[model samples]
Target: MITFEGASKHYPDGTVAVADLDLTVETGATTVFVGPSGSGKTTSLRMINRMVEPTGGTIRIDGEDIRRQDPAVLRRSIGYVIQQAGLFPHRTVLDNIATVPLLLGWRRAKARARAAELMELVGLEPAQARRYPHQLSGGQQQRVGVARALAADPPILLMDEPFSAVDPVVRTTLQDELLRLQQELHKTIVFVTHDIDEAVRLGDRIAVFRPGGVLAQYAAPERLLAEPADAFVESFIGYDRGVRRLSFFPARDLSPHEDTVFDDQTRAEDARDIAEGHGSPWVLVVSAERIPLGWVGTDQLSRVPAGVPLGDLDLAPYGHTFNIGTDSLRAALDAAVLSPAGRAVGVDEDGRVVGVVSQDDLGTAIWSVTE
Candidate 1:
């Protein structure tokens, strides 16, 4: 655990970078420090590795004052990743990842072997091991950077806007990759990002910092969205905080209707009658194996020959399916809004259609959970 007891940073000209921060970062969990620029989130992160010296107060890791250890030794024990990867331009990907291990006097072969293992661990191809930083794409370089940070298997990992330089698609992929790694490794992570969405998505707990280096509020993402400390924190979270909060609620409890679902082999006129009886304008068509085919509107079914199977009629795209067992309420809502039939399809682990829920039902679930 890392504890900042009134820890603060003051420049020679008296600029306050951090103001008496007294927060504890729990071990084996990701804690994000997020705020606007010049809010001292980066400075607080740097303080953990002694990269930035605090002019006042004490910072301790596992009860030992950070000042007691030599800066270099302390740094080598902590893994740090920064924006744009910060990779050595001339170094090969494998060599870059092996830097720390080699610096610590591991044999060349052993270091490279460990690097090879980490390269695969971070989703890089074995063939890319010989490539230079300049030869790799932006996403690959970030992966190499992550591999390098984990080269020595440090207990703590510090990331400062590591994904900010990448495009949105790549950024999300990297975020998912980090979450996967964290689940397996359980490292103490101190992540700094100006993006509140990234903080909410990745952080186990987030520390919101205000301008002038003051700590605004620190809490779990769900709580932060549900109840902001003040106007500053609330505005930082944005107007869609209520919607964001739905991510925490599971969709498993949502009741979906299977009455409007029909086998694709069923006659279109028969399916149309059943859907009309259920007061559903659209009906979900599924294959023999229960996999979702698409949606067939009752109007479309009525236009088709009475004896024709639903499989013979043109069906609208189903949009996407939300895993009822694993997905959150947000995902279900998204699926519903995007679906052509205006209903979200819920699927089991095998991608088999379980049932479907309308926007009204989703709204009810959201209300029940939020209330």
Candidate 2:
């Protein structure tokens, strides 16, 4: 949807921020621009909506040269969100969110209704509309800003470190929310961030820029992690990107043992034998209908009657678990982190016991990526 051809920018001070950049962001794709300070990532993004005019070359939006488009009309058609939310302090949240649509000549009632719908879309309450920016938390303010950008229902959005000012937990929430919104809306988006992890997590394709705005690599997260362009890009993505990539892979890869699931009716002694046979202390408990129940250790069965209910004993934690049949490596890693014990359990979609994936399985996945 967006293409940059021989784009370059130079400051009045003669510092080259970007040079001869040529790139394409697939329509409706979340293309992230990432780099350190002074890399020109920010400047390149600004040129998209003409916030920063390019010194040379043409930028095209769906094949029409953006330079020829009227700045006011072009901007109104392209949504923009920036760091710290950039919300006006005196404005009510609803008014702030309705800013873009109102500017586009939408009726007052129509704009407000649109704003309310967008607020709900971003997971905010309609009651918060009356609150001023000062009254809302920083995260809430960011949501308001997002709602405002989306207020006009523009075909494109340019977000510059939009989630950076908030706390990490809130930032993650916003990232996940953006992913969900993108999946539904599919707006052509250009996102800028300094954090590599954030770029990888959110970007459909990442453009890594070096000093002077050099484009190092533009590729999918897996491709970049599996094969970085050079030392600079490799260092930027971090040495552990391969393992970090696991978050995208489903946790179902890890499988738990098939026949050892405990349920409400199964005798405790039998469960113990199953666990003991594996040389493990516990077995995953499930319903007779194959839903997850919890877990029980073999040691606990010695204290109970032959038919002692699986639910009756002091239940162990549910095994570090995920659905099996997806990717064992992902499940194994989650299990390792969640496990107080050594192994991770796997359950099927129906919640029935499936198999187990161990740390060794995790090792193989990580090694394979690097190798």
Candidate 3:
């Protein structure tokens, strides 16, 4: 556990980064520091590892004053991941992950073996182990950085906007991966981010800071959302706090529209049963494997020439699919909006169609839980 007692950072240039902060980062939980620019989230994070020395007060790790220890030794004991990965350009992925292990005097073979294990743990291909940092994608490089941080098996980790550099899709993937890893490893992590949504998604406890490094509120994500300490925090969390909170609720209770689904192989006469349904005139199309292809309108299906194969006709756009059991309500809503038919297709673990959820149905599901 880390404890801060009136910790403050006053730069020589008369800048105040952190101001008399007092907080405790509990063991085995993620503590996120989030705010807009000049909030000193990064400065607070660096104080833990002694990267940025505090000009006043004290910071302790596991009951020992960090200032009492050598900054170099203290940093080596803690794992840190920052934006853009900060990997050595010339080092192979394996060697980059193995750096700290080798520094601690582990045998070269053992360190490399540890590196190989972490690479797979972070979901990297073994084939990429031989590639340089430049050869990997931005997401891949971030993975390598995470592996390197975990290489020493530190109990605490510090992340400063680590996922902010990647595109939204990859950033979400990385966020999910971190949550998955935290479940298994249970590291005491300190994360920094400007995005309230990212903080709500990954943080067990969030610290909302004001512009002067003043800690405004520190609480669990749910509490922070349900009750903001002041207008500043409310403004920072955005007007969509209620909508964002839906992500915490399970989507399992949602009842999908099973009858609206029609196999692409269904004959025009067989599809006549769907035309009388009160829902949208469009129906989902699926392959023989049960994978979603797109959408098809009942009017078009009704006009199909008798004896013509349904598979030979064109299909409208289907947008995207979200797993019923795994995805959040936000994802369901997103899928519904993207779909040309104003519905979302629910898929199984193997990507086969399970059913569909309409926009109205999804909104009702969200209201049921939120209300």
Point to the candidate with the largest TM-score: 1
Name the runs in model 1 displaced over 4 angstroms.
299-305
Could you tell me which 10 consecutive residues in candidate 1 have the lowest summed lDDT? 297-306
Q: What C-alpha lDDT values do all the predictions have?
A: 0.95, 0.84, 0.90
lDDT per residue, candidate 2, 1-371, as tens digits?
89999999988999999998999999989999999988999999999999999999999999999988899999999999999999999899999999988888989999999888998999998889999999999999999988899988899999999998999999999999999999999999999999999998899999999998899999998788878999999999998876776766665443345655667777889888877887777676767777666666677787788877787776667655666666435555777668655556666666566765556666765675446
- Model 2 ranges off by over 4 Å: 264-282, 285-319, 325-328, 348-353, 361-371
lDDT of 2 at 211: 94
Q: Candidate 1: give its CA RMSD in angstroms.
A: 1.6
The C-alpha stretches of model 3 lying farther than 4 A from their native spots are: 12-14, 88-96, 107-113, 123-141, 165-173, 222-226, 239-242, 265-270, 273-280, 285-289, 298-314
* C-alpha RMSD by candidate, in order: 1.6, 3.1, 3.4
lDDT of 1: 0.95
lDDT of candidate 2 vs native?
0.84
Q: What's the TM for model 1?
A: 0.95
- Tens-digit lDDT track of model 1 for 11-46: 989899999999999999999999999999999999
Which of candidates 2 and 3 reaches a greater lDDT?
A: 3
Looking at candidate 2, what is the lDDT of residue 106?
Answer: 89
